[model samples]
Target: MINEIQHTAETKMQKSLDVLRDNLAKVRTGRAHTGLLDQVEVEYYGSMVSVSQVASITLLDARTIGVKPFESKMAAVIEKAIRNSNLGLNPAAMGDLIRVPMPMLTEERRKDLIKVVRGEVEDGRVVVRNVRRDANNDLKRLLKDKEISEDEARRGEEGIQKLTDKYIAEIDKMLATKEADLMAI
Candidate 1:
């Protein structure tokens, strides 16, 4: 029973880390990346769909992304979707492909992005801490039910706390690296 609780808590903590990594990928740095637009949804045939589903996106250069829709008619719709996105990119239509050029970030804009990244890191830390709290509660319940001895429960609690510290430290390191990348000229 003690092992089961520890395994479940570890899995939950790993999931929290995965969420943080995904959120970081969507945040733009100083260069162009296709993953930045992976979440963009475009209107297709009266329905909204992810851009990746309708087109093949590629990074053409350090500041440009090329999107080619599988169907010719979806070109206009794809361009419209990018234009309306919060990314502030303008798509230039060429035949059946759309080219988006990433603009250089000004000092003020970079600072704003850094703030957003920091918020995401803090949210991740909260998730990990919540998981730790839940695990601690479960350990106490096990002790109350006499399912585990007092010594075992204490050791389990210590293990959970150590895991929480390790994951939180990992998040901090990732945030520092991303901040440096954003601040780099």
Candidate 2:
């Protein structure tokens, strides 16, 4: 029972870290990244689909992304989807491919992106702490139910705290690195 609780807690904490990593990937750093459009959905026929599902996205240059639609007819739809995305990229339709040029970030825009990243980091920290709280509660419940002794529950709680600390530290490091990336010219 004790081992089960520890394993569950570790799993939850690891998931929180994964969430942080995914969030960080979505944040742009003034570079051309196909991942930036990973969340964009384009209207395909009568259904909405991920842009990547219908098109191949590639980095044509340091500041340009080339999106080639599998179906030539979907070129306009893909361009519109990228234009409408919050990424602020303008797509130019060039035959079967749409070229998206990444714009230079203004000082104000860079600061705004940093603020957004900071907010995401705080949310990730909260998720880690919430996992710790849940695991601690579960440990206490186990002790009360006579499944685990007080000493075992205490040790489990300590282990969960350590996991929480490690994940939170990882988030902090990611935030710092992202901030630097965003601020760089």
Candidate 3:
């Protein structure tokens, strides 16, 4: 039972880390990355679809993303989707291809992004801590029900704490890397 609780807690912590990773991927850093457009959805045949579905996104250079629509007619739609994606990007349709250049981050913008990153990091920490709290509560409940001994509950709580600390450190590391990327010129 204690092992089961630990396993569930560890799994939840890992999921929290993954959420932080996905969030960081969306925070662009004046560099061209295909993941930046991962959230863009384009209208296709009366249905909305991911931009990557109707087109191919590639890095044209360090600062430019090149998107080539599979169908020539989709070029205009793809351009419009990117322009309205709220990513502050402008896509120029060059025949069948749409070129999206990553704009340089101004100092104020970088600081703002840093603040966003910090908020994400705090949220990640909270998720991990919440998982730890749940696990601890479960341990206490088990002890109350005579399903676990006092020593067993103590051990389970310790294991949950360790998992929380490990994942929180991972989240902090991700935030540091993202901040570095944003601060880079």
Stretches > 4 Å off in candidate 3: none
Best by TM-score: 3
Model 3 agreement with the true structure over 31-121: per-residue lDDT tens digits: 9999999999999999999999998999999999999999999998889989999999998988787899988899999999999999988
For residues 50-131, write the lDDT of model 1, one tens digit per residue: 9999999999998899999999988888898888888878889999879999888899999999999999999999999999
Off by over 4 Å in 2: none
| TM per candidate | 0.95, 0.94, 0.97
For TM-score, candidate 1 versus 3, the one ahead is 3
Comparing 2 with 3 on lDDT, the higher-scoring candidate is 3
> 1-185, model 2: which lDDT tens digit per residue?
76777788778878888988898889887899899899999888799899999999999998899999999999998998889998888999988989999999999999999999999999999888887888889888888889888899888888888888888888989998999999999
In model 2, the worst 10-residue window by lDDT is 1-10
Give the Cα lDDT of each candidate: 0.91, 0.89, 0.92
Any runs in candidate 1 off by more than 4 Å, and if so which?
none
Residue-level error in angstroms, candidate 2, position 75: 1.2
Global fold similarity of model 3 (TM-score): 0.97
Shift in Å, residue 79, candidate 2: 1.1
How many clashing pairs per prediction, in order?
0, 0, 0
